[model samples]
Target: MVRILRGLAHKYFSDEEAVILFLLLVTGTIFVIWFGAMLAPAIASLIVAFILQGLVSKLNRMGVPQTVAVISVFLVFMGVLIGFIFGLLPLIWTQVSTLAGEAPRIIRELQSYLSLLPQEYPHLVSEEAVNLIYAEISAEVGHATQWLVSFSLSSIPDLVALLIYMVLVPILVFFFLKDRELIVNSIGRLLPPQRPMMVRIWHEVNLQCANYVRGKAVEILIVGGTTYVAFKLLGMPYAALLSLLVGLSVVIPYIGAAVVTVPVAVIGLFAFGWSSQFIWIMVVYGIIQALDGNVLVPVLFSEVNNLHPVVIIVAVLFFGGIWGLWGVFFAIPLATMLKAVFAAWPVQEDIPAPAQEA
Candidate 1:
């Protein structure tokens, strides 16, 4: 046992640098997991700073002064952030309230429709089965409504936390964006001086993350704006809300589009039943989704996320299981970073080859 343990240690930890890297990684992961709630604001600020870095670089490359560029980009970010909060938040809240208010009516309508199923298809769907399904659905809807009402009423503390985040996050983001170099150098100082492997991994992560974030931002704007316009033209209620869902759905790749489709279809059906308007709206929505997946995504992300579909799904599921929404958003980049680490890691090429049959 001792001999096996020693061999394993020699195999993995022969290089002091590798040992240090492994330890640092373990420590960082543990720290983030342990204090994630307390550190949410800091982590959020870091992500925002990372995203804004692209604009700062663009302005700099246009021969703008660093300070001027930073201020310019920061101002633009603040403008959009404020606009979203003021313009979209109220509309979304109103629509959500509308949906909650209509939930009982929707349930009644659903039950009425289900009641016809037994007469229409007596063999396939028995009256007993219809009653059982209706009861289950009614119970679920009742629970959801109760939860929603409680959550809305109890949001004061949550609002307070949000206010605190709103105050602190921008301040942190501004400093991080302004002092990008100094901050990088400061973090660099904490690591070993001779870390080419780490540096390489950092470069890959930085490049991929920047490209992804920028592309996603553009994607959200283009897709959301287009959806809003289309829904408006179709005279759809809750246009802004549905558009927002469609836009953010890009974040989860395959899963988000499918999930949001349910609400869109349900709302549309309830509004127009099986009428031509609903059919037309659905047709338009399908077109938008198709163009987005086939055209817009390819143009914007173009080789940025070269991960396979299965890998993307697994990453989404794995990270989402761990960190909820933010984890879902960052899953692909984090997984890609892991891929980079494994690729950059110095492996033992001198492992004894399997002996020939003797």
Candidate 2:
């Protein structure tokens, strides 16, 4: 069996294309196995939180101690959460209540608009069909809102877990930062002397993962802030809530901006009667998209990850279909990790000098 495995590895690596295919297969299999295990989501969330805490460690190097930095970062995040809940929640609750109260009127308007269509079209869509559609849509909206509320309520346990994690994270991060060199040396000792190539690959993967996480955090903040400010200035209802949605949705990549814009525009139109405010909402979203596409994405997330956009879209759809919100949230990070694995095989390239030297 050992001899047969060795022969197969020799044959597989002899052909470059075959080697690539073999690597892809191995990566996919590993992902499936890991993802299928019930612990994948929790593991992914931990990795995310670790990355954020690692950033706090970097900030600590600028002056603060790890414990103080971690506390400071957590406090800042908490302040933002409190501000959002207090400032935005009331406005959103009021607007949502108003929208609910006007639901019957909106239904009437929709019916009137639908009635104007040709009889042939109307025949294609029966009264029962329209009612079913409305009922399904309304039910879905209610379910989504309920899920959000329930998720918030459910977070109490998660918060307790987080507090526990927070205490552990800083201790972990401090040692990680201080002993990073020792960790590298320890890993090197585990590998065979001839496998410096594997060490290089590991280093590359670490850099990619770190950059991707940091870039994403920055991108989300900028986009979310822009959306919030734009809506607030235009006096759009639920500006903060919509901005949060937009910011959070961006984790899903291209579809996120559009997903956020549709509901915001629809609600604005309904609440403000398709007037200047509605138009301004459309304009704001358009500008936001333009900035994200042209400036923000290019500046923050220029790494190609070697996956086609089509592959990304499909991953988002498939994972999102199964795991819902968490799937969408982690899709890009997982994809990026997969890309790093693919790029890990030995390749000769020059290392660029630091920008200061350049």
Candidate 3:
């Protein structure tokens, strides 16, 4: 068996297709190992928090004292959280309550409309089909509501865990910030002596990760603020909550903005009776999204990790399948790390230099 494995490895490494297959197998194995490990999620979250702390440390290098910088960043985060709770929570609660009160009337109106459709086109469809559709819709909505309730109940444990994690994150971040250089050097020391290039690759990867995290935080704040202000000016209900959702959703990459926008628009349409007010809500979301994608992201996050859109989509889907929301949250970071690893392989090309005089 050993001799056969050796022969296969030799043959595989000699051919391009075989080499690609081998790499894929290795990557899959690594992913499985990482996922199966008990500490993976905690470690990933801690690393992310540490990266944010390091950003604060960088500010300290620019003349801000360490204590002041940490306090300032923490205060800013708290202020934003407080503002969101005060400005958005009540409005959302009110709107949601109003919508709930109106749901039966809306359903009756929908049924009436569906009934009219068959009379208007008697030969085209049957009343039973229309009834079936309505029944299905009702059933789906009921299930959705039940799921939401269950989700809220289940979230209590997760919320407790999150609070614990939050406490640990600050402690970890403090140590990370204080001994950043030592950590890097220790990681480098773990690599084999023959692989000096690994150290340089690690440095590059760290830099890319740092830039991505810092830029993303800035992008989230800008986009969230823009959304909140736009919704407020347009007299949209739950403006702050919707904006906060949109902003937090931005961390998921391609689909996050859409997830927040579509629900908000649907709720607006239902609440406002599909009038011009609903249209304005859509327009507000569009403007916020356009600015976020074209301006804020490009300007702030341009130099961060550069993964292909396809890879990001796959990672989002894959991780989201495994861990739900938290998976979605960390998808891009994991993809970034994978991209860095792939780029570090010898087969990847370096940037070409311009032709020089002899």
Could you tell me every candidate's TM-score relative to the true structure?
0.90, 0.68, 0.72
All candidates' lDDT scores? 0.86, 0.68, 0.70
- RMSD per model, one decimal: 2.7, 9.1, 7.3
> 288-353, model 2: which lDDT tens digit per residue?
879887887777767645457787898888777666776778777777766775677543333343
Name the best candidate (by TM-score). 1
Residue-by-residue lDDT tens digits, candidate 3, 1-358: 9766655555435435436545655886577656744654457545655556765877888999876777676665556546656766667666655555556676777788789878998899789999998998778766655655576687898878866765665556556555666887896565445543455556666767777777777878788888888888878766766777888888887778767766686567656766888887787788778887888777876777667789889999998887777678978977786677556544423334469999
Stretches of candidate 2 off by over 4 Å are: 1-8, 11-50, 53-129, 142-194, 303-306, 321-323, 346-358
Better of 1 and 2 by TM-score: 1
Cand. 2 TM to true fold = 0.68
Q: Cα deviation of 342 in candidate 1 (Å)?
A: 2.6
Model with the higher TM-score, candidate 2 or 3: 3
The TM-score, computed over Cα atoms with residue i paired to residue i, of candidate 3 is 0.72
Query: Residue 214 deviation, candidate 2, in Å?
Result: 1.3
Candidate 1 runs further than 4 Å off: 1-15, 121-129, 354-358
